[model samples]
Target: MAETLATYEVPEHHVKMYTANVQAALNKEGGILTPLVSSNAYTGEKSQVVNFIGEVEFVERSTPYGDTKVTELEHTQVWISGREYDCAVFIDRLDTLKMIYDPTNPYVERFREAAARKMDEIIMSKFFADRKVGKDGTSTSAFGSANTVVHGNTGLTVAKLRSLRKLIKKRHVKVRTVRPKIAVTAEDVDNLLGEVAVTSADYAAIKPLVDGEVSSFMGFDFIPYEDNGGTSGDGKSIPSFQDSGSVVRQLPVWVPDGMHFGQWDGLTIKISDRADKNHIKQIHGTFTAGATRLEEGKVFQVQSKNAA
Candidate 1:
């Protein structure tokens, strides 16, 4: 049998333009974990699992005068897998021509903003799902559960932040620096303000509380979510510090290298014409990516009680 070709031909120049536009938009989306972990790439559509090797501890032994004891380095593996993300923008023939002619087109900017938001959301959701939760234990030894779980649901405050840092230290989570990542919903912003009175004499230095510039607090790289309550396609809101039935879960704290994001090599923009006689042009942005928890021990969940 003969192959049926596409009805309309997409010009080389148009395809190039699509590629440039999509790439520029993707570059504008800055995600939290994108810089913290090492990135990897794969070739195929199926999920690719990579092994993460853990550190080995060496022991000191006393030997005979002329004899020596020898030992080999040992390590453990944590497996991680990633998938692809794809999105398409459809434009009518007239609209496409307008975009080509108008350098300051609002349409292009709107499209770029939407694409950037989606890119960030995908990475954040993956980060939330690929972590370990902590429990209400006095120390790290008595905390932790499976399925990307962490403990602590009490609201955010300076003292609670210190407790989280102490828990992280107790776990001996080796970190390159003193900073840990902490995310909070906009609603929690008010909770934090209540802890520090805005009318006090110290409010001058604590103005981030009033102006909303509190990027770091209590040794955490504070990440405030403008909208943490919206639901995804699966009917679940973007995972933030929230309550689960009787147990309330607090935010996450971690070392930079504890997680990783892997991307496929040939991430690009694809352009084509519609098969239907509508004369619509399709611009697609596609890339393959996966995230995994490299060292569960390096990440901690802070379990908190409901503020009464």
Candidate 2:
């Protein structure tokens, strides 16, 4: 049978667009990933604001007069479970128009272009674009409509898909995520905010960045939900994702290079104190992969140059 472009079926480009955009948006970024740094890169920056506080409630309260204040208690504090993404934007974008669209009667093409633009707006603004966006905001390469998938298109202007393929296939820098996680004792959290503080605190810390240099380490924190005295699958209420620390904070990160992918035999990270050794205190750091709940193959691996 002669092969054809299938938007929703075999190599469906349409389905791929939505899935790719959605996963990349949620998994990594929050909005339009753009290249404020690179002119137009395969990867871009993403900004996300994690919740600083979880659910809270008013405790049993009692009012007392000035004389009775000494005899009556006022109220107490309590904390609820769960985590919050709060508000964050992930930015992602293509460097140039990969697909071709007719400009004369460019309604659909215009919409695709518009989507790209709106994505840029949302990312830059660090705001969530209501989920009312349509295909009009998306665009396809010269191959065909963004609604179409099946990367194999031979009927169009470019009979030689090989040439177009070469254009998009190149090794470039990657915009990856930095989710910092650490193991802590319940006592550690109490030490951070003090005993009277009962509410949960979710935090995000983006380190100070200098132009041209890689970013300083960042830290993120979340409340760990627990059940039946456990906290893994059932979302057991374990230690909070981000805890407060008095002395040296324990913020660990697994920096996945946005540019490299393949049979990665191993990964390594180097650390040196950025602050004045006398003022900020010199510190050393190490790296290691934590236990992941994801099953192998469930992870999405972007293809790297010459990576089979």
Candidate 3:
């Protein structure tokens, strides 16, 4: 009798384990922006709409009941179109049996990280991108320049932070009520730590230099983002432009409610045998998601140097 080898077929228990692992990775490592913004879940459609209502004026009733004042409710909408994203890897049965350790875990981690990066990239692009608005979502509105803080041939600094805070204050946004957030690269943090004001005890309570990170300061929560995966069209992750022969980085600064993320299908995984490819085991992960800037007034751009 000839010896038989155990088949490397995917079992039901293994499928659940892989799915749980990928989901855990996404929640821990990949979801930096998902929880920081407005989120909505939809089904049976590829598009979702977020509605906003304008403030109504409250006029004093001098005559007590003079012809009952009437005001129409103003409504506007932002439409989010979900796009599918997926990643997959196949393992040959012979190779799986030959390997000392399983390779599925690494593939799951890769898929989780790629999906997470894509989500943040979408949110970052929406900060300055034109937004679809109006009743039918057929109108496009550009991000207002008044909300932008110019680079001035410098990196992230206290002065720029003050200017960014001032811009939001001028819009009458209550800083105490709605905490603002700013996403910065590692270079930006280094620039801040290099500043005398940030390191000096007279200006800051915590020593940023010793801490090696800026958790929060200047009435803005700092989000450390190193991934520079470029946006659509130009392929520059953090929007940048040439200024005086210097490449300036456009960092996004916005409130939580200013951006929206829509999900038609959450992160999902599938493990199956590919019959067309010699019965190789395939591990695949996918999701359908979209993000959009809810309003220009609540979102701003801070232009800084690409390098300190």
Against the hidden reference, what TM-scores do the models get? 0.71, 0.17, 0.83
Encode model 1's per-residue lDDT on 1-308: one tens digit a residue: 43222344556776666556545655565444465555666666545445455465666656557455555433433344455667776765454443542434544565556545554555455544533222321112222453223334546566666666777776676533657776555545556667766556433334464455646655666555444355532112234343555424345556667666667764466666676735566766666665555566666655433454
Clashes of 2: 31
How do the residues 1-308 of candidate 2 rate in per-residue lDDT, one tens digit apiece?
Answer: 64222111212353234333433332233212222211111111121111112224454446553333233332221111111111111111111111212122222233333333333332222111111111331321121121121212111112212232222232211213333222222333333323213433311111111111122221322221112244222222221122222122121111222111111111111212223322221112111111111111111111111101
State in Å the error of residue 194, model 1.
1.3
Stretches > 4 Å off in candidate 1: 1-10, 57-61, 64-75, 93-115, 127-143, 146-153, 174-178, 198-214, 228-250, 303-308
lDDT of each: 0.53, 0.22, 0.73
Clash totals for all candidate models: 17, 31, 2
Best-fitting candidate, scored by lDDT: 3
| Weakest 10 consecutive residues of candidate 2 by summed lDDT | 298-307
lDDT of 3 by residue, 121-231 (tens): 677767777877876678888888899998887898889999899889998777988889887776777677678554566246324424445467777888776645454
Best by TM-score: 3
Pick by lDDT: 1 or 2, better one: 1
Ranking by lDDT: 3, 1, 2
